[model samples]
Target: MNGPKKEIPLCEVCQQPANQICGGCKLVYYCSKAHQKLGWREGHKFKCCAFKVQYSETFGRHMVATRDIKQGEMILKEKPAVMGPRMSGPAHCLSCGKKLEPMKIKEIYDFYKCTSCNWPMCGPECEKADIHKAECKIMTDRKYKCTIKYEQPDKTEAAYCVIAPLRALLMKDSNPQQYENIMALESHLEDRINTPLYVILKANLVTFIIQVLGLPFDEDSILKVASIYDTNAFDVRCLDGSKRLRAIYVTASMMNHNCKPNTRHIYLGDNYNLAVIATVPISKGEMITLTYTQTLLGTLDRSKLLKINKCFECVCERCRDPTEFGTYIGSIYCSICNGPFGNGIEKRPMLISSNPLDETATWKCEKCDHFILSRQMFWGNNALSQELMKIRKDGPEKFEEFIEKYSQTLHPNNHLVLQAKLALLQIYGNYKGYTLSELPDHLLKRKLDLCHELLELADQLEPGWSRFRGTILLDLQAAMVVQTKRDYEAEKITKEGVQDELMESMVLLQEAANILRVEPEMRPTLEAKIEELTRFLQTPE
Candidate 1:
């Protein structure tokens, strides 16, 4: 009754059928085993193999091709979700919903220990369930822009950042709405669900829901969580014992495509929901796009992120620019004036094309009568972006190597340099058990220093009333609280120490309030924290 298991023509050399497909993965037929092997050996290995499955709903706003999207048009605007103890105060374990024991708590310095998986908790009993180790490892990495870290060096000393814990929490309880929604969507996608793209979307959504909730997940409960209407995917790194798998996203996937997009995208802790808006004008019918790769680098690097991960060549406007637009302005400074110049005719006098590689590439400003050396400009800022991209390719373990190299090239206090430092801090704080007390004093100092630098940048670049700036202030305050020193005699000064700590806590809370003063709802909660800290600070001395 059934047809033969579909088999393609055999290969001539090995006489084996094609084991893979090609292009957009729309076709699957192999002629002989040798040809199949030849295809893979040639370049097929790097082709569509990484292609992910996508669903209509998961495609988000991108599904509607609202306007005449030019071949290399820009699309989509995204921001990372605010998360962790830094953003919304201290976070608890996602699995147990128990506030993880703080590493430096006054009496008992408690720490969370995860099994081989990075999922955090107080002990082994928590690991019994199919835990969120997969998502935890991915979140622990710095590439995602998540910088939560453990202050102690012991594996047991590590704990979950708010985002990871929140994801864990979502997993713990049953949500009828989420389940029904997923079921309905899954049914529609079932026929095509087996496709690689579809499979990838399904996997991304599943892992995303489970990880964000921080609880055990069932297929039925998926819909109860938010939907990934418009999202993108990241090369999330997770481990299954010695083997590692990449976490993917469907909501993040549908952010159309672009080379020089206006808005940036980030994970908001919620897998389905991403905080997105127009970095520039978003015309109707235009396929909203987001840059999956870091846009800081020039064309070559941007192309690489998309090529390797999304399996598409990006010929965006910026990428096609002969001058690399204003990105390389720092590298192409006017040699005559030895000053930066805009990409106009002003700096034409100092344009010198020494290297054959930059023959077509424009150099110097026509306005300023000064020669701008391409090589010199390349070394300053452009070089760092290129070098960092190389380092990231080596994976997270090479972070130190990347930082070391970046430090040599960029200013020690440069924003890029600070970013590299923050990456290291994240490893120490979130992934490894490097406690605050045990950390090298210099490292802690460096973390604090960078935090301040970032805060300054946030204040200057972001709008005064921007919610993002407020969130950054919140994170800084929390980090300071953790790093700040406290003295108390448990026996003699129970209530006395409590009062002092509460007072100190209020001081920190007040700073946070200044940032979120306009956010009325947050004010009450912050006030409550201040009150609680006051009460605890005043414990019967």
Candidate 2:
């Protein structure tokens, strides 16, 4: 009493019902000579060979520098195992993640949907979409149907819990070797079960995928899939720029988290392939690290965010230092002198408890001996964030007003103030009334000052050739270019000074170009600026 062998699907390459397994891996299905040739030519053959990724327990399955990795060296680049919408509300095309037409369900149904399964698709081309095909067939076979209108906004995001796991499961049928990679990842399932998202998934996704579809997935398997996604998935922009996606990378995910990491990843091929490059020189046998959070944030916020999201309090070198590498980006204005704590340049102003690692470690001012409670700092940050959000729509004038109002209450290098200043730096050159040419000499100097100050802070927090530093470098280059031109035009500089200024501006632009060439969003803009600066430098002053 055995059921007949389950029918295998058609060729993914040609959408034909005929099946010819790949001789190399026997994972992919294709029909005809031309289609198999097309598949291999499109880079499928290389992935079929597989990457030799090693893991370890110290960093909980991490990658290392196989050799001395030079700065800006390309380490690994591969397509993600799975990709889907982020855990946020925004309706998009299920197949390609393009924006869905709002309130157009019947119209969507008429245009989209596989010929048989009736799941939403952009067109007939996506009928054989890797993750959706099997899931769609199961939904159709089990008489399960999604009741929500196809065009409903964010309906896909509401089901984020199930989509990722479903994607993982579908990968099992399509690519068994890659499925082994997925299973090898750490899920931390034991710790995740008590979380709110797990509970919700247990109630909804578990029942739908297992009970409704009768897919043979057990509770443990489903939880493991969810945990894998939670730990390994990255919020990435889609390959087509249609929408943002949570991309589950394999080797890239193995790099452990560090607040001051030596490596960074630049997504390529529309977020399909990722290039993990060294931002600093990494020696052979050294463990590679990547920052999993925004680096511009201070230690407290970075540590807390990592703990909440990744389930680990970062005790990295940056987090343990009360000085935060002498930036004092985390400290508040000392009650007495109204300056940042731990700013020990002229007079040291901070003392930590002997055990700096302890949860209750005390931070006291050396100048006024004023002890600032953790609660005050926490609430102050929240209050400032709320106020900034309220005035975010207003011009740079409002931002300056906000900064001046709290200049004494907050540290000079406080995260909020720095963020506002960064905003103003961008606005000064691009906004209508404050366009670059229209800015007064004083304002130009002000913009240049902000760029230099922020660049220095970036050197501390986001060291090496990180995206933040690259952005600041580009801003600094632009400011220097304008300032040099103004100085030359106004005859305010000697011949040698003019030459020196031009030289410095040219170097800044080239440095920025070096850093930003890897970033997809900024590369075009920075390259254009570099071309302009190169031409400007060539001309006689």
Cα deviation at 179, candidate 1, in Å, is: 16
Q: Which candidate leads the pack in lDDT?
A: 2
- Candidate 2 deviant stretches above 4 angstroms: 1-57, 99-131, 147-157, 238-242, 337-362, 494-497, 520-523
Clashing pairs in 2: 91-154, 239-270
Candidate 2 minimal-lDDT segment of 10 residues: 347-356
lDDT of 2 at 393: 46
Residue 427 CA error for candidate 1 (Å)?
Answer: 18
TM-score of each: 0.33, 0.81
Candidate 1 local lDDT, 25-72, one digit each (tens): 323435655565676677655442212333465342343333333222
Error in Å for residue 59 of model 1: 13
For residues 200-219, could you state the per-residue lDDT of candidate 2 as single tens digits? 88898889788887777788
Local accuracy by lDDT, each model: 0.43, 0.72
